[model samples]
Target: MTWKTLIVRVTDSCDGTCYGCLWRKNRISGFTLPVTTINDIVSKMKDFSFDESVILCPNPLYNPKISDIILSLKKVARKIYFFIPVNSLSKVRNKRIMESIDELVIVTTTPEDFKVNEENLKIILSQGFTNIALYVAIGSHTINMDNILSLVNMGKEYGLRIRVGEIPYSTALTLDIKSILAKKGYSVGFTYGMLYGYMASMAFIGNYPVTILAKPLTGECRKLFIDPYGRVSKCPLQTSYLRVDKVTSDILRSLIFSECSIGCRRFELIPKIEISLLTPDGKEIPSEVLSLLEVISHVNSLRAACSIMGFSPSTCVEKIRKVEKEVGIKLLISKKGGKEKGATVLTDEARRILEMYREIRDMVSESLYSEKGIMRFKLG
Candidate 1:
């Protein structure tokens, strides 16, 4: 399977001295990744056909040539995410970095940080950076639900997106966060890894999306990190790395997977297929319509189906009506309430359509999982 993320430490330097710092703990001196080294890495990535998203981690703002570094990395990256501390916002002095990066990921350790950097946050938001977020490092301190809620409320107020990470140490905190968000009318989608006990959950407060992740104990590393010394490794926390010194393609591929075992089945990659149906006249039926029909088939109420699917009742009905008008067939049957409540159900034709759609979807999935089809997802 192909790796989906590439992380580069543009500089191993930072002005702030936070707790649990590996840099200070190891006494590693401040160093900036040179523009020449960055160009070399980008060329190697291009040669390897690495087109995934790149994340400049630790504190890229401390690097003097950050603007040039971002421009060089952008040549091979699908998108560039710059990670910096809340105090490093002052180093963002020009529009060069602002105009290039796809997202500005700000690292904050506590809830009071939102108030401390209120003016700076306003300035950055006003300067044309549309996709910015706050990464709360739960590993840095003993955080509770109140702290998380406070951050969420401030995020809503400032129109900022938020994510909480490093939560594997506390199962109670994870449950509490999900429970509180659910009780407050926020819809949460949660899942945990069976083998490693990794917890990940997602929800949205207004327009901003909230994410929480508990790092897996052991799994297939889908991320490649390039440290300041020009060495590469899949895991970010790995201490040693393999150096790529203008090597051949075969040698480089070997070096990339040298740490990972052969035929390791910790995590498996699967193909994703989008199922779409078209009418005879060429009108496309959205996948949402199929999902709504399926939900209504079980719930027997349009309102209940919409609630489960995160859609407004009126919006869902309008979508179904459009499809029905185009296909020239009624998809749903509605009954008005008398002494009992109103009810809804799919028509016979709708059931047939659902079945046909499922058959087609399964066939497509089976085809894509074949040996020939699996080649498309392999990394070069």
Candidate 2:
């Protein structure tokens, strides 16, 4: 799948002492990304299609070039999302920059923050900024239900989008909020798919939708994160895996199988495809063999493909030979060389088989989606 969203960390300098802030824990020496770096990242992103760009910073107002950052990203993305602390709304000096923002994500924590956020929302609305969302981060401790309901009512009054995100390793608070909202006849259902890494449930309040995001889930990465230093990763919360220098299709394809580390280790939700192909001798072709074959076709090196697939050379050869014997066809043609350099290519029969498998796989995937294009996820 093409990358649907690109998250760019424009800055890491933050004044707020929000509990368990990821920026504070993983911030680098370079506080903000320069305009030149932003342009470079945007150019690289054009190679792989992305619908929207999210401007990330613990507090975007702290960046000196915040205006330029937003303007630069506006040229590429169809929509630009800016994250700003709710209390810092008054700090926005450049009204023109706000025009470039397609959505304003106002981060709030407690009831007190929401109180301030309500006033802040009014201020922005007066300035003609209507595309706004209130992002509420809830912790594991017991919360005041009255205040939470008050926040909900306020959202309903203003017709604003509300997103309640579960802080890492917490579930009960969001579940309680979901239960409360569901009981009130609010339209609540699971979101089409994961956002960032969080699996969310949506609740509609009048015309606006309130999304409650559960803790981060693993597998099937759909988001690409670019840090302040122009390094790339599959998720914002993980370590940078590659740089943005001369990014090719190979680099992007490699991320498809890249594993990202999750902060919460308790639960995992990964969507996968199980394929069963029986040969004449009652043998089945392993999925890993197909993946290895595909990687070899792309990189043109057996050793490099083996390293990427985490397979020993001898083991990969044995698997390939087994599949070849089962299918009665030559799957791979290899020319031996150094440890990491060699010519490896797929045979005509192998390409046909891989193409057929991929077509069936994509067909099955599309079958799992609704007519509106939302994935109809099932659990067993």
Candidate 3:
């Protein structure tokens, strides 16, 4: 089973504006919105049977109420991490917050921030936060190898680990960043942007083994996402809910056990079959002769029946001739090959036998359906 992670956007708004933020596109109405209540969040998390980590991402450090929410989350979350992006103005402060996290992530845009990031790294280290990771966003600007080398060297100096992630909205930059990181023995993590699903699918199929930090849990394992308003979503990217307001253990189990009602188009190709021998004209044929006629209905050609039954085509032809001679009626409608390939059809005599057999099959199915529930049988 695949491990799932949930990233909950605690606030509807952010303090500092980032250039390419996907959440900004889906903003509710105006500026600020109330954060999701702790009770609702915990209730949603408990619906799942399997273990999962939850990451909380608030707008910025400027929100005074964020600390209270973080404290509440720490109580319920199996594991928690913070993503703090550093820009020119607001820097890292409050060592207490850093110490509280399992992992502290710093997001940077440029090589110039390498020095500032290194300085911030010192502050996190000074606070005694051991698990610190850095992310450098390679955007439209040309990234110099020297700057990456400088950041790598700085990470070594501070005993901090570094990870590179592609900037959202730039395909060229994403490819370039991935190539550079691949050369350096690091893989880029995807945040919000185009082709996110494709990237995630590729990661799973390729067996990359890297953690997708904030995705909804699914399959036999019941991982999921909860919005700030307490609405549960399959993933943060989707706004629809598998369930809302209350995600109980019973509700989750019901969803897991329920079979998919969605039907497939292939059911239309299944041909009907029958098992008796009376003609539509009310003429009765012998049971032994009818059995041979029934085989012709299934495979119109003697050759086809022979292939299916693992008997010689000539033997099947002789059996058909013998049955027709006994019944005193035609059983095969032969067609000659030309541009269209040669084929055969069951004669009227054979079709009558098939219709009777189909009636018997339908009766049996109806009995089973009445005795046992439809849910007990697999739907085609």
- Provide the overall lDDT of each model, using Cα atoms, as 2-decimal numbers: 0.60, 0.61, 0.45
User: Model 3 residue 194 lDDT?
Assistant: 11
Cα lDDT tens digits, model 2, 1-380, are 33356677777666543444555424535477777877776665555555567776477776688788877777766667787766677775467877877767776666676666466678778887766766666554554556556666676577556777654222322233554454455544433334434555444555344666654344444566777666777766665567777576567546534654553422322333455466667778776676566556656767655543334589789989988887788998776767634588899988987777656644654443333222234222
- lDDT (Cα) of model 3: 0.45
Better of 1 and 2 by TM-score: 1
User: What RMSD does model 3 have?
Assistant: 24.6
Work out the TM-score per prediction: 0.60, 0.59, 0.46
Which window of 10 residues has the lowest lDDT sum in candidate 3?
196-205
How far does residue 187 in candidate 3 sit from its true spot (Å)?
11
Worst 10 residues of 1 by lDDT: 190-199
lDDT winner, 1 or 3:
1
Candidate number achieving the greatest lDDT relative to the actual structure:
2
Cα displacement (Å) at residue 60, model 1: 0.8
Ranking by TM-score: 1, 2, 3
Question: Which regions of candidate 3 are displaced past 4 Å?
Answer: 15-19, 23-36, 47-60, 88-92, 114-120, 138-150, 167-223, 239-380
Clashes of each: 0, 0, 5
What tens-digit string does per-residue lDDT give for candidate 1 at 1-380? Answer: 33345667767766533334443223446777777876766676675544344444456776788889888878866567677667667766678877887667776656775577778888877776756767665644454656667777887676555666642222222223444454455544333111111234445554345665544323333456677766776545565577746554455455544443322223434332356688777987777687567657756778756644435688898999999988889999887776435889789999998787767754654455445655565553
